[model samples]
Target: MTDQSTVHSVTYDLLRTLKLTTVFGNPGSTEQTFLQDFPEDFSYVLALQEASVIAMADAFAQVTGRPALVNVHSSAGMGNAVGNLVAASHANTPLIVTSGQQHRELVIGEPYLGNREATTLPKPWVKWSYEPARAEDVPEAFMRAYAEALQPPAGPVYLSIPMDDWNRPLSGFDRVRTVSHRVAPDPQRLRGFADRISASRRPALVFGPEVDRSGGWDAAIALAEKLSARVYGAPLPDRAAFPEDHRLFGGPLGMSVKTISDRLAGHDLVVVIGAEVFRYYPYVPGDYLPDGTALLQITGDPAAAAAARVGDSLLGDPGLAIELLLDLVAEGSTRTAPEPMARPRELPQTPNSPLTPPEVYAALSRVRPADAVIVNESTSTMAQQLEWLPTTRTGSFFATASGGIGWGTPAAVGVALGDRDRGVVRPVVGLIGDGSFQYSVQAIWTAAQHDLPIVYVVMRNHEYSILKSFAVLEQTPGVPGLDLPGLDIASVARGFGCRAVEVKSGEDLEREFTAALSAGTTTVIVVPTQPQKAML
Candidate 1:
């Protein structure tokens, strides 16, 4: 028989075969068995909470555009990670999450950290969930998890690894290689789409994050050129996928339904690529587009295309569809590039008091590296910031598509990691609100520990300013429990080994932001503003 001591050694070998070198987790008692015989090539990323672990993995997958590995303890740990897992499911981030399970013998009876349905607990949030039927099947279970996590509309997958499995013999098992299938568009469908666009005098292309994720930028641009179409990024893409510098590229449409309609008016045909038809917030109601407008959507996600508020849905691989469509359309016969939308005028800044959000945004805009990634969660400063620092590219910016707070800070960490490997290590600037920052503030430690260069710009307004705005707009008698008081953001960041500064005015912002970026490591700049001004 193979020696028991070599079981974990073999398990580590299997992990290496899968190329899962990084493991994100918060250790617990039940996980110690799997941690045995740890290999030097495998790195453990310590997160203070399960949420941070899953979130970091989510961002890592997004930036790297591949499946990422994550680990958690028992049921309780899995529960803590559920929220972010849901976000991953929504964003289609492929992740493999393994949680330690009680030993097989103790699972049916009393034991510490035991939960009967540990694997099924996150069923709805994960695309696949399983517990190995036998000790030797654990490694194969991981292979299944990795494959499922990489499927289109990829999402988090869960595996419950029993304690005994870590030390079990696996002499007969073969490590399975995971393969991805390529999806191509139907030639006839592509030709029909091209014919429709070629026949339309005023056509536009609308896009979402999938364009970037699916490597469809060239195809999307080619289709746009074929149709002489104006291309606009989706209402609020979580990240840029299309190049914003292209003349045919228009700006992002915000969450306002009326605003989207106003902007898309006068177009006879709208071709949406790799995006949901529309995503709206705050209950705005109106026709999704102006009267007499027609919408066509091409996406890898069938559900997104089908669920669009208004559109003719074409479900397929966005890149392939665009490539085929480009072949069917004629070369020339182009229209004048539509005039670039006028930039929003910045709100006036008052110098006598705290720095206005717009002033802070303007200063950041000036100092920001042109190619840097901007991860925004500045809820209160959204309007002013958008006006001041308009995203010019499809994939150069990112925000919370799940409408969840706390994603921006850690997501920036993931973005930096993703960029690091591609030799495109642009600086990551996180525009986060103080209230939002608290959601997963522990992520700062990950950034600092990895020596990731990120500038976390905390818009400190001392309140859940978005909620306050809603309360006032509704004319509520009093807004209750909305204040986020007594939070010292700068100190919190510094405690995580990051360079920290507080900026209360434009001058302070200019000096501090410049210094933070130049410091060349994780830094937090707390920009304090009046509550009302922060909301503007």
Candidate 2:
């Protein structure tokens, strides 16, 4: 006979059926009831803080190519996780975030841990948010959250669960019925796109992260080769979509439209795939395209295409659209190949006191694992790092596109969790700055708690280097609050239960990086950096 006290047993059974074995969270008193009767098969990851929890889940979702399950405490926890959720929304990572609330009955009278509008708190960040009406509906709410999170324009979803729901008896619970969506371009539309590409003399492909997420890399490559076209990655791509070493691959285009237009001036046809129309920094308005140039865009997002200034937009699944376009273009094609662009020029190494940032990146490139995942947050070293560590594979690199600091270190921990294999666990390295590291140093505790192996290479420049550089460029003297003085990052990492080291020279950097990679634990290596007058 089934015992009446085993109400949560069905909930656990449903969780298992949905294959949500890993739960990421930072627990609190309110969450204890929901965490009760935890199954042996399900593993709970304890994040040091709410931001790290959300960032880790975002990375996990990106790497696994599926929606990740996340949990957090009440109001405070949700507040902490907001920043990371915004970043995830911008990157289009599918995540399901759950938060514990006070009992439903107490919500009316301002209970100890009550959140009146818990679902509305994360507005504009989450694609959908809800609080189930009954305890029996909790599992079904999760189903809806998962589906909404994974739909087109994938992003994080939120669900608030009251503490009493877990303890309540279940009645008339039903299985969640899964829904599938098919979004493919019409055959006639694909043919029109192919005709445009085939008719053009000089065509180029601009690929983006959506292509990588949709598993359209091979199809993109085929399309590029079929047209013998040069391919450029979109400005500030959050993830890699094509191999950088391929002959057809041109380097990343800068964010400015002026810069992009200058680079694309020679080409007559520009085919943008799975990428934004154009993302810019500050105002530097100019012509949307070069003289007489035409644009064609194929994307999974209809809104993105509709918003583009100049383009023949085809809204559909990237893989299917590219495949059909290739089939259509197979009949007639011209072999007009443009002169190959020169390889990225290597930055000259300098022997300056308090090491240059590029030299540090060069040293990192030498010692880092060939297949390691890089999480970059060194704002001053943005141009230099990209030049030095050009990734050849998709999903091997990560960065915060929202320009928010403190994401690199925690995101690295999350990436390691999502991809753990035998022999040498894939090295997750953070190239972060001193000022940025201070913002999220607490994440080191999460790494230690989970025994997650990661190497944080802090560029210790001793100031808000980027801001200082900007001040210098403007010729402003005596800028207050730009200096970050006397903070020992290595000691802080060690205090948080991570191995730590400080590198004063190039020799020290090379030796310590090798040791950290093989140590098989979280390690922080601080490389003393110098302030550069110009952005590298």
Per-model tally of clashing residue pairs = 6, 0
lDDT of 1: 0.78
In candidate 2 the C-alpha lDDT for residue 435 amounts to 92
Which pairs clash (backbone N, Cα, C closer than 3 Å) in model 2? none
Best by lDDT: 2
User: Which residue pairs of candidate 1 clash?
Assistant: 240-394, 240-395, 241-394, 241-395, 244-392, 244-393
Alpha-carbon shift of residue 424 in model 2 (angstroms): 8.9
Instruction: Report the poorest 10 consecutive residues by lDDT, candidate 2.
Output: 1-10
Query: TM per model?
Result: 0.92, 0.92
Which ten-residue region of model 1 has the weakest summed lDDT? Answer: 1-10
Could you tell me the lDDT of residue 325 within candidate 2? 81
* Per-residue lDDT of 498 in model 2: 95
Local error of candidate 1 at residue 203 (angstroms): 1.4
